[model samples]
Target chain A: MSPRQKRQLSLEVNGEPYELLVEPHWLLVDVLRDQLHLTGTKIGCGIGVCGACTVLVDGQAVSSCLALAVDAHGKAVTTIEGLAREGRLHPIQQAFIACGGFQCGFCTPGMIMGAKELLDRNPAPTEEEIRAGLSGNLCRCTGYVKIIESVQVAVRLLQEEMAGEAGAPVSPGPGRHAAVGSGQGGAR
Target chain B: MALWPFDYLEPTSPEECFALMAEHGSEAKLLAGGTALMQFLKQGLARPRALINLKRLPGLGGIEVGPEGALRLGALATHRRIEDAPLVRERWPMLAEMLQLVASPRIRNMATIGGNLCHGDANEDPPPLLLALDASVRVISRVGERLLPVDGLFTDFYETALKPGELLAEVRVPPLPPRSGAVYLKFAPKSRQDFATVGAAAFVRLADAGRCVELRLGLAGVAPTPVRARKVEAALQGQLLSEPLVREAAALVEDEIDPVGDIRGSAGYKREMAKLFLRRAVAEALRRAGAAGPGPT
Candidate 1:
């Protein structure tokens, strides 16, 4: 074992910038928990296998435990705590709560972050796509029934909000445009 | 709970990283995405005195097509980038699909292509696909640079041809000919957080006359390393992609692989699954080829 070395790093979390002295040995998950005191991101495997430590790095879900705090310099990160804005939960969080997407809640943060990416790129996704999107995350409590239902609920809520704002859109529903425009959509 | 202490050097230049590698030799390791390396460190499988972080190194992350139609996959290009790249999706959608099958969404966002290849896990889905695509891995050292075929890149399970002081630059996959289709299939138990029991990738080329002109079959997780099934290819060469021929080719994987029993599967079961995956992968590739504007005959 060797003494930990400190490094100067800057990171943006939940739309707020923080500059801190982090050890080279410090994992992003640890920094978020111990230093920043945002303990929403839980640690399960410590390795990348379990998605329990998932967080959004630049709007993409990543395992915080595998990420070095130094590697996150000059990047945008969002922990589970960042999802609620001004005491109002993000749509996904609300959907999770409404749909009962968690059981023991140990895997809820990672699952929410994973589904958040899917909804960001695709507000409406098929069950297969939803399964693929959340495949990395493992949940022993709910058997993924409520989790899938949670994403569906989020999609419906987002579509209803969009349709209400757009003032009655086409037959495909709001934000339901085919991925044919960008060719990013896969499967039905 | 956290990474062990080591001198971290985020070299802004590849030359600087390479020079540091040459100086530290085996005492150093390149940090791509840290998905695999970090796991290895936590498992006590790897520890080094220096980590040559490659993210800061210039020209290390990006995917582009070369003038010659080869797909240029940078070492630092994350799987998420590859999965989302329009170029990769347009030309080689199978690669994108393979990327999607690797780990979970969180892992894909941070796992680099170089890190996946260098991780040297026989169960990884990318190597078999890269091997089927006839991809080449570019390795850079302070001494010089060299490119090796994907099949030749792996020396053993958790071992690669990468020298101690060398860094993988990129994975270059040659363009497939027209009227070609490739598919990678893995038999991971539940399709979530499971290592592949048997993974097979098939790249098939149909002739203008409607016969099988060329075939490249690659398999992973059943052996010490991912292997190209030249035996199966030889059996199918010039043969009509008849159901009979495909069955014969599928049976050949059982003969060629030297599988090891593991928790995921017994050696016998892996051989069985390899045969199964080979058949499905070939049929899927052929079906895709046929669907691509009625290939040949």
Candidate 2:
């Protein structure tokens, strides 16, 4: 009769690699929050229904609460804690602040992470697309209007950031209006 | 949702998986995506001694379509992959649309089609549509491999026909026939992500003069297992369908489903909904086939 044993998990989280021993039953959230002490990834519903524990695994959003930590071995994971660069807040975080997108701050990190994934995929998504993209992540504050407005502002900010990055007129995606009106109302 | 301590086993090959399955027997559960099984673990509904993860199993995560338009979805192909596949969107639009209606995007990214089926939840969205599309699953074990029609896969609540030491390898979906149209409708009024109050799927093929050449109806959330309404299909086969006639055939579902409703609705409400949705799904399928007018004759 064999006893349950811990397994070694090696994963790159937010550009940092770590090697740790994790229990077989332990979830990715457990490894991230408890082991690594990265408490930004919240566990809301425990089940996958709430978007509280959402994280990016290999660039695709998935529920950390439902994923096994060992299964994340050899993969790249991005939590809400990983978004900043050079001690400056990511544009999504800035947009959330600029637009007052959050209330009580419990769902903010997850919302920002979800938005980062969404904007990374489609730089300029429609309001409906933004709503559907973040469907899994719920805001209990019922601040959906400002949350959507925050995403819209992020679209413009990201477009401006990309336009600045590219140093010329750039087409973000298939969305025409988000691109053609580049100069007007970008920061707001 | 504190999971019990268990040994984690990652098998790189099917033979190794089968061997482990044989050794662990029912005490071990095969891990595919772990979206549902994790719930089973956290809720203490399943106290497995080990979890044999299928993530490392090679050649099982592919999504390939044959030249004949048949889709061979490897067991590990995530719902996100299937939903975003270009060929699937072009050929099997009904399936693509249905995948979008599944839980949220995060769940879809983590949930695999094989895992969803093997989870054997009667209220899930995929089984009804897969049943209507005439999908079959390739189940493998140490002895050999065999294909089981999707209908024969589910045995009961959270149970499947897969024997011990066997695992689902792939899901094979045959191409839709010419002049055929398919649809899946989930009646979840509360939230788009909620399990269906009742789910219905229909595949219809038309011959000349709009006569029904073939019809298949599948329903979920109203039975012990996802069920095909063969009696209804039999009644509509080779007949020129009218709204009244289709409604008459759909009414047969009232007796076919055995729903034990909880918060969704009463069992009687679900049975009634099953009949109504069966009729609507068939009508929509017919219209999509261009076999009938916008309003059914």
Candidate 3:
């Protein structure tokens, strides 16, 4: 039996209001995946060594595994599931799918979430910033080449969208043959 | 991983935090950003009875520019806030560079500058640079407030001057003198998350004719705590800015520091690396002062 008190936790995750009875000690990652069934927020190395549990808390990326659920009260949380809208994927999400950003996919949610944060803060981050932005996250399967390509594509897509390039269809390129939902290793 | 069970208090005012500290003193841990503190709890290194959340406190997160171009950085200022500040980038580019190299974006977002300074981990990079800048810390408690020189903040290995009931309030950094430049350089093997094996920060002020007027040298991962190479500082105080002077000052650093061997690197390797970093950092700082200010690139 877990000796923890239940608290009324009110949070806005993915632009939706959620009021759940959460244990005071429960991590935000647990609340998102276990209670809310938002499995897109995966947990890896619960001690914060791995950035697989990254999520946007109030538009800033934080390691949800280390963040207590109670601390997220009155805050906004965004997970991988929140990246798409109206049957259309967010440009970054689409770019990741197109650009072979993930190989094993265990680290995809975190990679995308971390990328989302960088683009939000600095729309046109340099190559060094992208390397530094995703430094906390470790992807053993795909060398960072395709991941870097994915971010570059997203930058162009998001930039076009910002400049009123609405409904621009993502074209095929080096990212065209990326496997979707297969979770296999990308090109060596 | 769930946090260990503990009572929580979110105090919006300093008085409430003080009162809680007085009541729970050693039993409670004040949490700011919860980056390092939460990691401690999760690892079972600490099991405080209560957690006093400092996030709700007002007036603890602002960065104010004082008269004489001093910077008064609040304890709760996040690394992101400090790294991107126009004043910090313009006046203290070393701080900006160090912040950019610290951890990563996700960690930097939730980690506080005060928390990083307070942690005092040898492998960490900020404390040494701050000490080189001659910064002072403002600590508050139920009793009153006290200002401690950054050099005096760290006592022994992994220990600081902070008492049980007191909290670090702010860090006051005086403006750098003209003709002076500072640089922080660290060597981390493998990826960026790895702790540094050797780190050096140098602040050098040159004379009108390009001679060294003043010098402050700080080294990390080369001592139990981040420390100033006082012997090296004394050697280069009045010397001309040259390769020979830099080599002399760098040679003195190896004698002043006593680093212990660990998985990061051998003690001898650390010493040699320290010398290399010191020489490079001093040369770069002097060159910056000689040029027409450090231009943006």
Candidate 4:
């Protein structure tokens, strides 16, 4: 009978603290895209069936469309826009580009976010684990072969970075060398 | 599309939650993981005047083993937690395996077990397995707390037996009986994320002579609510384990189910698959029990 009231939400996004008044019914994806202007998080099949709205809430991949902005009041939220740091892309992002993981780019952000969470938990996941981790994300293009390869390449790049072999900014150019990409030629 | 506007209430304790529920009653919807409720809200299926957020409720989220070796799963435990929990995996691997097959990694991370149960969706994977395992849920309100068997939790389509002001706090799963085994088999012809056309779970305890000492069967997606196939169980219980006996008992599942036609399958198709899965689940459970060694008494 009464009008819905906005609630105060205080949370951290991309390492920045924010305090805003949001409607109680506003989904986290809307708040991220509209309120914060972080449109990198895409919303597909808003009913949580599609993983196009994946984001990290407290380092765990969750469907932002299913989470109310109020539910994220005290948590650290990471959108796909936050994956890069200091003008350099995250390894997963670089891997997605190098491995041709995206064709339409509609599902790329969510796929990369999901892959980030997967690698964060299990740095060196097997192929089956990679597929299982990205099972929630559906890519209408690329047929998932390159997406799986991208995650595998990301793992090797991360392992190389950890070993201090290639600390330089990973070039997004073609023919960039990946340890795992060596033996599998023309697969990209 | 935006969700319909609603006021929000965040209650930090069970007493506060119960008070809010008592005041708001049917006008309020309690939110745990928000995976199921959020979809309902977005689709205009539910228009609660107030959304009660239960994230801050203390002692409502955790997995612990009770003194008697029973597993106590807090209502707020996510499917991801259940799938990865060492205690659940070691004690009730069937439950963990079932949880692993739910939706996907993201949905599993966001969907809570309590919310899943309270949603009372027959297409879900956990209810039938929980029913077959003889699990019970603890429902608490300001007045008192009571235990309801998981089999009795679902009353109808998208309806639960939880009364107004009553909240499901935790699920208590009894430890598997000695020489007993359980299996949950889901038949999803579509993608892995799709709901099962006919999901079946079976628990069997074998006697030393390979006779079935006990058998419990539960099915989902073939009825308005998850149901225990009592007729099938009765046919198999205390009988000598055999291929023909299992097949005959499983065939009784067709008569026990009341399926509805949907995109997954026709009612008749689901009924047939229910019988097929029931047979496989019972046979696998019997084989596993035999491998577990001598039965208790």
Highest-scoring model, DockQ: 4
Model 1 lDDT, full chain set: 0.84
**Ranking of models by DockQ:** 4, 2, 1, 3
TM-score of A-chain in each prediction? 0.85, 0.87, 0.85, 0.89
Position A15, candidate 3: lDDT = 95
Model 2 chain B: worst 10 consecutive residues (lDDT sum): B288-297
User: What residue pairs are clashing in model 1?
Assistant: A136-B104
lDDT at position B219, candidate 1: 91
Q: After superposition, how far is residue B144 of candidate 2 from its true place, in Å?
A: 1.1
| Candidate 4 ranges beyond 4 A from true positions | A165-188, B291-297
Cα lDDT tens digits for candidate 4, A33-123 = 9999999999899988779999999999999999999999999999988888788788888778777889999999999999999999899
In model 3, which regions exceed 4 Å deviation?
A1-4, A164-188, B291-297
lDDT of 2 by residue, A43-97 (tens): 9999998888889999999889999898899999999889887786776776777
Model 4 residue pairs with clashes: none
DockQ of 4: 0.80
Docking class of 2: medium
TM-score of predicted model 4? 0.95
Give i-RMS (Å) per prediction. Answer: 1.3, 1.0, 1.6, 0.9
The residue ranges of model 2 lying beyond 4 angstroms of the native Cα positions read: A1-3, A168-188, B67-69, B294-297
What clash count does candidate 2 reach?
0
Tens-digit lDDT track for model 1 on B1-297? 766688888888877777787788888888888888998888878888888888988887879998888999999999989999999999989999998888887888888999999988888889999988889988987788999999899898889998777789899999978888899997888556577888999988888876888788999898888888888889888878877677877787777899999888899998888888887888888887773322221
Q: Can you give the lDDT of residue A76 in candidate 3?
A: 93
In angstroms, how far off is A92's CA in candidate 4?
A: 1.1
Of the candidates numbered 3 and 4, which has the greater DockQ value?
4
Q: Candidate 3 on A31-87: residue-level lDDT in tens?
A: 899999999988888866678999999999999987888999999999999988877
